[model samples]
Target: MTTPTHAHGHGHSHGHGIAPVSGRSLVTRLRSLMPLLGEHRRLIVVAYLAGVLHQLLLLTSSGIGAYVVARAAGGASLDQLTGWLIALGCLIVPLVVMSVADSTSAHVAAFRALADTRAKVFAAFERLSPGYMLERRSGDLGSAAVSDVEQIELFFAHTLSPLAVASTVPVATTVALCWFDWRLACVLVPVLLLLASVPAWLRRQAELHGHELRDSLGRMSADSTDTFQGLRELVNFGAHAQRLGLLRGQGARLAKAKSGHGRRGGIEYVATDTIALLGILAVLVLGARLVIAGDLDRSLFPVAVVLAAMAMLPVLKVTEVARELSMVASSADRITTLLDTPAPVSDLVSRAPAGPVVPHVRFDDVTFSYRGDQRPAVREVGFEIRPGETVALVGRSGAGKSTCANLLLRFWDVTAGSVSVGGHDVRDFPQEDLRRLMTLVPQDTFLFNTSLRDNIRLGRADASDDEVEAAARAAQAHEFIAALPEGYDTVAGELGALMSGGQRQRIAIARALLKDAPILVMDEAVSNLDAASEQAVGQAMEEARHGRTTLVIAHRLSTIRTADRIVVIVDGHVAETGTHEELLAAGGAYVELLASQLEGFVERAS
Candidate 1:
């Protein structure tokens, strides 16, 4: 049961700061997108073939114009010109048809690849430890899931086709020009390079700006979530104005960053325009010179210049799209890191075979600590709970009571020692099977924004409606639920905001009863209830504990007075273990805790 620690990648620091996700070089970023295409190999083949054919049709269109001008320059007949026009129509129609079909195929293949990649990303995270997941931000993780995978779509839909087309178009265009005259092809090559370089510079600036933008957006989302969750606190303290000012400041920073990138992007567009115009001018002047010198046919020169000029479309388009795609690739890297996160310890042990039910649990010399802390939360702690016994763990706030609850549930493994249930090491039990044997009513009860019946049914998804009501009755929640506007159908509204604390606690207890696990852990379930409600819930808890190995964590002395045994914990170790009267008579940690609560109880009663 030793909880393992993983060494993060070399650049990862142990400090309490968020580090940028690492391990993606330019090559890996490109490779990650390649797998998506490989996954749909057949579709990719068909799509690329369509793209190449589409480019060829375009090449043919340009060739038709070249033939028309060359024929006219040689003083050919009007009848021949009319025949050339008809051939031009044939080339133009296929050019349009194949281009449309190519786009359609790319889109279909891109979406299917995206779907497969998304499923794998989510599945990988699902296999990681819950403890590791809780440490990350919900908003940041949300951005990774929705926004990150979307970026890869550009790789399939646009990047792939443009790459294939750019490669073929320039090569084919260059060869045709070379056949006419090498000087024209030579002049055009440099122009394409200059135009492509402009966007590369723009993309470098964009990558830096994009990183800042993503960070600001993540902070904005985190702050927004915090504000909504703490609305009551903010209103009560009149802190809304200050929080709003902070949000506005972050928004302004993001806008400034975006506008700066936009300005640089405009400069890039102007650069591309200059390059294109220069290439056209060079081709025109050279073609005219060749015609006057009688080194080229007058009609062929115009047609050659036009064909060379059109070839810039795919090259220039690829450069521009590649720049925008770097931002998309940023999202891809973040998502890939999350999906690639390795589990700290591999679950290699096969599940113990299920046989006789053993309700007993034993912790032998257990030790545990949180991820970064130097001090252990629970150290050298050992105990045993026999079948059908009710044991209460009583402690001050940081005495590791909840840590013990987490240990029993196997939310994390111990740093050292063994924890076993029913004579099987907890680690040897399948996670799902181990969970099936235990149920918990946490200190802070959470009910989904759903009906009372549906909320209770979460304990056992397959439980019948009648079985649900029976469990509710046992938890003393049936009467109040029946009196509600819609009875069991009443909406709980975000974490049971529609119900009182006592009502939520009852619902949680009902869930535990419905689960009907042999081992139950109730952590301060009645702590927030008023005296009358506490009395009601405590009675329900007592009923629920019958014939089960129950472990209750309580702050209130009265709640554990009837517990078969009470263990007092102090500074991660059990200081005393005995009946309530025995511990009180012993006059140690229990005596001090009881005295503090007695004063509060007297004040409330008065």
Candidate 2:
């Protein structure tokens, strides 16, 4: 439940969840993950210690059993036999308990670290370019956040401690075996080495299949989400079968990936097991020869055989989990790639602008292009909205009308020039401060699944019920809200699905009005409303714009007529700037657009 602190550090500590280092290789990916464990790193260390203790107790039990086997038929006494039996019984309880404790602690630590990492990923999302989200599917990102992070648990909980025990116990047992008899130890060493190398031999195949499986899982998540959301539309349009067929194709691909991954896992397990069994067989054969030649004591030969199995056991432990090691590696790669994506905007940690700032917005010779674009989306676009002035931006589709609004908001920095607000560069203001001064009411404003009252209250959480109603009245949302079964208490449903497009737009307008920021940017807020609804929303829009610096990107000719000045954009530049009538009289780009709409030459609204 701990929150990661958003501070640059004097070396990393518990509060910082993101690692400073990054690399694409599996080993470096793993190294990067270590820094993110934060406070839970101590728990992983404890788990490793417990795993070692558990293996040591198991080895002790194995050695004692060999003593009874080698001596019972050699005329050993009943008392000698009973003492070994009691010692074997004494070892079992702690061994089982320590084994469970080791696994349980590792799992707890891993899951907590995963939680911390997930939280950090979400925090990173807030600072990443808002444009990045527009280019990716929500479900694909969700799979990374939820499923990918969850898969990494195998690395921390199962593989890491076992790998540690595999490294420690084999060397420790080899030393113990040498003390018993050096030749016997030498006989088992080569076979144990082969057993440990099985995973490495298949690492490439494992990585390939692992990546394919992860890709299929991500695609499945995204397609399934799309199928669900569009089910109603698909059914209505008689396209449901086509969507279902697409899903079936995806399912087949996912199944094939899982099958390939599983087949490789089986191969790894068999190879590891075969090598371990061979090591024990070699020990028995060599030990029998030594015993027959009188070069080794008969009693010590069984102990040597037991020690050989002991050496193989640790390696077997590591190779067994190696089956899932690819999954851990693949998941780690995805998580690191996302966490390492460069933040599009830097906060610079500058202080908020001083004094009573005006809400006027100015885009001065701004030029901006989206990431990976050859041509600029907005080129040399310049305009200004003085305090309390309402400016309308009109353009044909893809003429970069919305780009001007986005530039003023600083969602993406202008590539070649400055965007200023209140006579100061927008880049100098922290994003938090800029957001506080401006509110955007896009055509599709997201409404959470909550009571209507609460949804509007999101604009200003401390606003009173009376204040909420007053804002709704200003946006003409009050009448419709009152007619609902529960008035303001009615649930909005997911994305406001229960409401019509016009009603939703009005709700958004009300929310913005409630925020009462000095600057308002409405990007085609009423573009989707019908004739009747448009009139109501237009009046609401006028009410909301009073005394506020407003920027409007409108599609309807009627709405544009009310703006104090009109700026016509075409091909990413200003085509004309004047009042609606003045532009019509000038016979410039605005006149052509107006004539096109009225003469049926243009098929769509601006």
Candidate 3:
């Protein structure tokens, strides 16, 4: 069976690295992950309870210390100190247990949420039409799947849950303080507002920086992809230095962006810290005034200070989390955009009547234009291929050869006319059902970075070892495949780079044979091969075409000579249609094209 091949020019890596810590938008971005949180509410509950218990233990230690100090200053007995110490130990044990349990549970929850998110993103990608995926960059998609997804884990594991607890604890503590001393509670309110507001301001700045950082990273990633994918071209043309200079500029731009974001972050931290210090100063001045005025006793001064200091821990923890949340927020926005992309096409089951013959593909006044493009790629195109007919399309680039092939495959719906297969409108058939009826081999082949056997079996998931080998032999790939150290089991790294272009083509042909579909479409199938490999692959193509409705996009003139019918397309219109000789005799566009290639045949024959 044939391996898949990625197209050559589609890598999208724009390389600003991931944004700095302070430049993230936590709230806006991480909201999507909340649905998954709802899905695993039980796990989240357990982790949250543990975190709350840990917070309570932390609160108790400070509260208990306040009681002990207040009593000792009032000249309480030694026995009271011993009793307080025992009480503190009780809080300590549970704090230790809850900390460990919460950490472990939080880790599991993070991984589960991330794994589910990744699976869903991949499934969404599958439902999208190949035409849609082709228009996007590989690197940007990868960043969403890998880097952006990773950013969300922090929010899921801790930040979001803690926000609720953090808010609750501070308000509760403030109320309790008022019960003890109303003046202290009143003084603390304004200070808490100032601290919260500081981070809120920082968050706004972070959101802007985060958006800029993500955009820069995308550009940097796109550049990296272009550099690596075109490495051979650069090396062959001796443009290595020139390419390196270009890459260096992209890298420098990214570094400068990152540095600017970092500087902004430092400013935010300083501003927030100054606000916190102002809070402490406000508390100290207020408590001192109350004590001197005798509105509060001198003995109560330390307890008020202790409570205020204890309250700051949760407030400060939240502020720190705020910065982290901003970063996670930026990641969330990217991931959400990817997930929200509409998949207009979806898998459908075949519902044809039992024993009914499968319908042959037909196009009736079909027209299609890509989104945002002014001109239609295929317009008023009409054609038909009966069962078992080998129809070849001959055209120059952008003459709608590939566009016709794409429409017939139902990659996009025709804008004006109907496209049908087996007497059913293409839209009526399930996407999977339509796919199952056809096997496609494009000019570009994409093989996974995986074992050759696995790539071959992708054609027919249940095919036997012998069948795979037989298909490979028919496609003229078995000899070279056998020569590899691991033979059929050899790994073809990243688009089958280990194999020659001819070998990769044969493998793709083998896969089409294994699919055993009623319809086959081969676009520029043997265009990349030398004469000998072309002859072998040509024979394999003929074998594959047997008893199937075959559509070939012929780039070379010789291949279409044996086609049952040849259709000439020029400037998005059908210029001629006939057998090879009939078209030659017509003295039209096909004849002109054939005349240009006559010299090559004469040289080969000589």
Candidate 4:
């Protein structure tokens, strides 16, 4: 009703229209989060240190166990055995303290950081152009806002501290092993090195499958959202099987991507387990040889083998965690890409006068196109609506009717030329300042899932109950609202209100009337109504237009018969303009359209 989705096309399916965007590095993606994470940076650092220290304590406790074994095997005194055993138990309290500190700090910082990131993402969406939101799939965007952010949480909560510990604790343990017998450290070093190499060797594969998994997941979510939102339509048309088939297609793609990602992870998991096992075996053989050759004390042989395994333990954990980073990295890529999406680039001038204002609206050779569209939706077309006049715009569907209203409201900037209000370019006013002077009643009204009273109040938040009721009465929405169970307070929206199409139109008209803006743009407001309701609401609309500049985007000729002037648009350009009788007398594009409608009417009657 506002311009069709495009000037030429009817609509697009969910998964087919996802535009390609440049991928970003994980570190580069993380830079957007620096401001949000700055608050908790200290806590994150503390968490890392706590995790490493806890791991060190565990390794130390293991070493004490090995030391007690060696002393017992050497036939040490009972007091010596008791002292070493007691040392291991003393390590317990600090271990408990460090574990609690690590888990608490990591999760607290991670959750708070995630909360901040989610808010920023929503805020970015708020600041973007309304047109941008309409162009994207709601479900795909929802996945980014909800699911993608959830994936990033894995890195901070479960993976991050472990990654830090892997980097640090293994090196500390390896140094300790070197002190025991440098030969033991030698065998563990190659195992740690090989396990660490797994991630780097498969880096390309990780990135490839990560993107696949994320993209397919978004596609499936979008398909599901589209299906659910249009479930009623699908069922009414008896197309349930068709919708199910599309959903299955989306599911199949997602499954394929998941399988690829899992296969990559499996490789990393196998490499880690294999390398660790080999290191343990090699240490056992070497330690046995050293004891037999009498080059090492028999009591220290088993201790050295245990130390060799402990040193390689952290590296094995590192590789295990690395496998999951594929998802985290991909999620980060999507989020940052969203943040980087360019908002409509423009400058709004502050020179326009403030306060309640609506002047003559003029389009001076206005040319515009939606992003990604080749040809302009409206091109080099000019028109004017003088203050306090009622003008009707009539055209075949997709003739840029609603686009004109979008321009006046500054939902988008013109590609070339200018649209002006009060003889100043529309961009001369801040978006908020410009929108305050006009109201657009779209064909499809979106009501929030809230009370009916609250929905009406959205037009003018400060309007009183009396004023609201007056507006509702003017739009003829009052009678039906009063008949409802809760009257004006009845809950309304997706599942609430149980409203008819005509009834919803009346509510929208009421909302526009409440705003009381000086300029009103109504797009087929009465199109959904039956003849009886249409006549009543038409009278209300007629009265509402008095003393205001009104632009009616009409498809039905009967609706605009009372309009003072009519402008005929053809393929985004104005073809004719005059009073209804004057246009009919001219016998131009207007007459051709009128004749076609008359022929259709006669056919329907027959």
Q: Using TM-score as the measure, which candidate wins?
A: 2
Candidate 4 structure quality by residue, lDDT tens digits, 33-65: 456565887887888889888888888888778
Error of 1 at 83 (Å): 4.4
Q: What does candidate 2's lDDT look like per residue over 432-532, in tens digits?
A: 99899999999887888999999999899999999999999999999999999999999998778788888888888889999999999999988778998
Model 4: residues with Cα > 4 Å off, grouped in runs = 1-36, 295-303, 345-356, 372-374, 462-464, 493-497
Which 10 residues in a row give candidate 2 its minimum summed lDDT?
1-10
The TM-scores, one per candidate, come to 0.90, 0.91, 0.90, 0.90
By lDDT, the better pick of 2 and 4 is 2
Top of the candidates by lDDT: 2
Query: Per-residue lDDT tens digits of candidate 1, residues 1-606?
Result: 334332221112332112363334543666666765655767666677788888767777777777787787778888979977898887777788777778888888888888887887677666665554556565565556666677778788887777778777877888878888888888888887777667666555766665665666666676777777778788999999998998899789878877776777777777888888899899899888888888876677877787777788888777777666656666666666666666544454766556875989888888877766677888888877889998899888888888788778887778888788988778877777888999999888989999999999999999999999999999999999999989999999876888898999999999999999999999999898888889879878987999899999998767789789988888888888899889878999999988878887799889
lDDT of 3 by residue, 14-88 (tens): 223333333323554566668865466677777778877777677777777777887788998888689887998
Ranking 1 against 3 by lDDT, winner: 1
Model 2: how far is 560 from its true place, Å? 0.9
- Backbone clashes counted, model 2: 0
